[model samples]
Target: MVDPDRVLVPTLGRPREDEALAYALETFPDADVTLLAVVTPLDAPLSEGGVLERSEERTARARASATDLLESVADPTATERIRVETADGRPGTVIPQYASTEGVDHVVMYGHGTDTSGFVRRILGRGIAATVVERTDEPVTVLE
Candidate 1:
């Protein structure tokens, strides 16, 4: 496959596969690698203040996770081409939407399991990677 201009890799606070990030950084040194984390709104009935606080907390954690993953890889050479971002929405929706609208030439995602919970996997069904493939026309590469 041709080298992508921009690549998107979606992650949660918990990563199912750590190598996805490393692979992108290694394989596409010239491409902009965006580590995107999705913060899905909680459905719990809480006061406005409580909801806002919770949202802020989730977003912070999401950014931290992306930063941690990049640090874990310890590749300082690719730092300039990498960016971590947090988006507000369901992973299944936001991941695909971002890839389509953000001029992403490729998407790299972990296949099968997601996060650290079997419960979440069941709720999300086939997985976020599968969702992206089904929803986006961009080339998707799934890493097991």
Candidate 2:
């Protein structure tokens, strides 16, 4: 079987996001998996600290959380195959950008279903999966 060499899974701390990562690992046993989380800075300060300092702190926390999520979902024996990452920007834009820059072979993302509608969805359209599909040439696997 031809296995992907590099797989990127963009997660948003959702249950379905974890499911997508699990599916990717199971399907491509030998691939190098990266669990990525994108942190978009809020217009309003997220913390009382200085903007730059708070952003840096938040990014660090996000990286740690992403790493923990990856560890929890990945098989103990396959722990060495997975890596954790965090980027600063919108998920849709950052995911594909990371894939291209890092030479990712494939992207796996989770959909939040069609029933919900809100400002975020309006801003991002069909969400990260759709944006990544439109922006990248690499293969995309979407798990709902």
Candidate 3:
């Protein structure tokens, strides 16, 4: 069987992402997997010891958490196949851009259910999963 060149998993501080990634690895054992944790910075600059500062710290923490989470799931020798990339942009935009440039054949994103509406949906417009699918030539797999 042909293994995918890469699988991109977009994370947003979700704990379940680790489990989903594990499933994807098991399903495609030979494929390289990348766990992406996007750090979308706030519009305003963070004040000293303020909410924005805390949020930034949280973003860093999330990335660390993701690395730890992924490490727990896979063997150390095979861990080289797993990568973690962080970017300061929208998930929808970053994911597709990475997929196009990285020669990714499949993108495995966590599905947050089919509830689209409000500013979140309007701003994201069907979100990272749909955006990646529409923008990239590769196939996208939404893991619930």
Candidate 4:
């Protein structure tokens, strides 16, 4: 059995995530896959409510949304190897941190293809996927 310690799926309310998750299951049947939902805090500076307060609110919503998204995609009858976690932090930082602490051996993710327009945006927009690749020592499989 291929024991992939962790599989990270970056979701943004897109249907493609289902396909990605299914693919991961098929690819690593015995691997322990944890669907990671990274909640990126808002970029604006601290205001009346304070930075920490705003961050907390954003984090709460993100966690709730992540739970809903994962619940919608998960197969309850499937094997017990799958788990879900939501973290409030930068994607690049949080993903690798979780993977390292969790002893992840693999990172499976789906990449958004280039839009109909020229390839520049696609190339440049691969930051998240690329960052994950660069930051982690584990193998990464990016599905198109």
Consecutive 10-residue window with the lowest summed lDDT within model 2: 43-52
Task: Put down candidate 4 lDDT per residue, 1-144, tens digits, no spaces.
Answer: 456756666554344667667777777776777777666655511112234566667556656665676666667665477776777666767877888888888887766432334565564354556677899888878776
Model 3 misplaced regions, further than 4 Å: 44-51, 54-59, 113-125
The TM-score values for the models, in the order shown, are: 0.82, 0.83, 0.75, 0.72
TM-score, candidate number 2: 0.83
Error of 2 at 25 (Å): 0.5
Candidate 4's error at 143, in angstroms?
Answer: 1.1
1-144 per-residue lDDT for model 2 (tens digits) = 357899998875555677888899999998999998777655522222335567777788778778878877887998898888888876667888999999999988886433457765675456556677889889988876
TM-score preference between candidates 1 and 3, better one:
1
Question: What ranges in model 4 sit over 4 Å off?
Answer: 1-3, 12-15, 44-57, 112-126
Cα RMSD for candidates in order: 4.2, 3.7, 4.3, 4.8
By lDDT, the candidates rank as 1, 2, 3, 4
lDDT of 3: 0.70
